[model samples]
Target: MLHYPAATPSDPVDASDDAPEAGLLPRYLARIGYKGPVAPTLDVLAALQAAHIAAIPFEAIDALTGAAIDIGADAVDAKLIGGRRGGYCFEQNGLFLRVLQAIGFEAEGLLGRVRWMLPDDAPPTPRTHMVVRVMLAGRPWLADVGFGAAVPPQPLAMDSEEAQPTRHESYRIVRHGDVWQVAALIEAEWRTLYRLDSVPPPAIDYELGNWYTSAHPDSHFRHQLIAARTTAEARYGLRDNRLTTRLVDGRSDRRYLTADEIERVLSEIFLLPVRPHWRPAIERAATAEIVG
Candidate 1:
């Protein structure tokens, strides 16, 4: 696990009503299909988060294809906004943080260690997840759109341990000393999602984490096909060749696709433009392990 810098007295979170990067705000709003007010209120934040998840997909095609994942501002804008590609945590949350800041929200970047799908006795994982911390009227709320399969559809309150309802599932944040463990309710039981540290990380941490996740041989993203997107009615997640649609009423439908069908699904279901060179990697991923 990579050690992150400790939290200091510096305030990295900022709000600017007339942000110089405001030129990108219009295009971002259009990409998400959001036509709401651009204020820094809770309503705008929740709407933007939901809209983003619905419009943009969570994917790892670059990693699967052995391509270097760039987390810089210009690269992120070109790939996610200008191009028809989706990205993992660092790119997703990095773009989201910029959008929020451009809209005059007081937001900061956060780091987390993924505990999702890990066994109870499993060793601690690395800090690879990226999330956003937003302060609205002095109350802190967690905003994240990068978690592939079970992303929170709405912003979660950080100070509460009660079950917070979202579009698909209910999530809660439980404090463990200085760390906060986030959980999602599934099959009537709460399951661990990830453990987040409150300290705001430096920008360089994202570049390092992105490289490790996309380039490391041990990283599952390089070996599997992970894609996800949510809608008003259901959340769709694709692992390897199997696609699962989880509805809001607690019902789910799963289907396994053939290698030949991967491209169609990637384009039609996930809304990602299928590239010709990605076919080889897609074929390998279709035959890889089904469970991660």
Candidate 2:
């Protein structure tokens, strides 16, 4: 179930005032480097999505570092805006949804089950992923900017089966019964990304999902460090001290980094500010598999 946030007609705050203050819109725009029209048009939607993807590094370092996390836009601002940092799905997409509404897009929040690692025939994964559905020109498009490295750079038509091309890859959403399966073309093969039902998720549902994803013993984010960011040319990622880059032409390169390079990747590539106390733990985490 897709859920529309509370409203008081046209007021950006009313749309999704999850942020502590209504004035966060301008900061959000500037942070993403968007200075174009805010009209509810495909151009604006595409531009915003692409700009956000380029500007934000989808990382779980804060969670791994024991920093506080909340889905509130205020927390997003505190963590990402000036910190030169990033967050996982809830923090990223929650902030993105508020930005869309503040700008005039008719946007709603939804949740998805990540099938990225599960076989098609395996039991459905939990609804742990967050997505935004925006209605523009009477058509609904899926605008997801928080799914990490393999994410598309623009909004995609939800009802169309045709592949939508982006700077890094081509993506398509296929429908089966009441479920929608999102897929991306990678290395000449189509890979399922995630799945969503017609039902929209409420805020409490997100809180529960966030608990499992952030604190559960088996959650991937609770372990070693992982971060990634994309540009028009290549995808850069940090999995511990291993740096991997995949170019637009399907060319790929991988190498392990020295301790100094690891710090640089955390600071420069991921655009994150490293705290002194967290550095030693982070360095050791680079090669160790953390377990509860």
Candidate 3:
């Protein structure tokens, strides 16, 4: 089995606050595959969000490999950007938030509950999810690229309940009291992704939440091989040994993955590379899993 290092949250993770150097913006722009304007305008926000989803991905490799999760923006830059890998919500949104701030966007961090996969009768899950809220033209827009589902390819308006179209699907938001629920149109049925309140979260709150969500022994990510990324055509998912793809026309594809195939898919589908030294750990993780 994989030997997981002890998770300690005493270490402080700090992101770079200095303005980007001459070449830094180009490098980051290359990473996200976005050549569009870096302005804080609405058009720029939507395009950048779409480019992020297309370039980066959502993966649970750290959780699966028992690696400690670091939610800092610089950590995101080094790991996700330099490493050419994808990350979960905290990392993804953290990196995006810094970019928006650098480019002069009034982007704020918000917490949301994970209610998408739970049973309809189940109570609200913890506020483990993080999303970026950008303000443009006196309106708030949500930019979330970390969700595994095939949600709207662009940011959804905070005040609009109408279904907004994207390159892939249509999505809308509904406000209830202090909470705002986001849903996507799938097969003509509106499915809830998650819900959030307008309250802004401090940096420390995010740190604590990231620690619990990623490092907690009983956390769902630690035990399961969960990964997902969406494109204009389909949404790819991985759970244990199953690789599932759901397309836009409602047709779906499912397949089982062998250990070798799993590694390959990690590179090809999820844009993650398993270092030669890390193979044993991944191998052990697969063997220890009941599904494999």
Measured with C-alpha atoms, the lDDT of residue 238 in candidate 1 is 89
Better of 2 and 3 by lDDT: 2
Best by TM-score: 1
Task: Write down the lDDT that model 1 would get.
Answer: 0.85
lDDT of 3 at 14: 23
| Sort by TM-score, top down from the best | 1, 2, 3
Better of 2 and 3 by TM-score: 2
On residues 7-65, what C-alpha lDDT tens digit does candidate 3 reach at each position? 23222222355564324455567797665556667767776776778788888678767
lDDT of 3 at 105: 88
Q: How do the predictions measure up, each by TM-score?
A: 0.92, 0.88, 0.85
Better of 1 and 3 by TM-score: 1
Name the lDDT of candidate 3. 0.75
Clashing pairs in 2: 1-199, 1-200, 2-200
lDDT of 1 by residue, 1-292 (tens): 1121232332222234555564577767768877766768787788788889998999999998888888988898889888968888899999999888876789999999898988757898888999999998889899999998799888899999999877688899999887889999988888899999989988778777887899988898988888999987999998888989998887899988888788888999899989999999888867866644
The per-candidate count of clashes, in order, stands at: 0, 3, 0
Writing each residue's lDDT as its tens digit, candidate 2 over 147-249 gives: 8877777788898998988767899999898888899998788899998777777789999888878887777787767888887688887777778899988
Please identify model 2 stretches exceeding 4 Å from their true place.
Answer: 1-21, 288-292
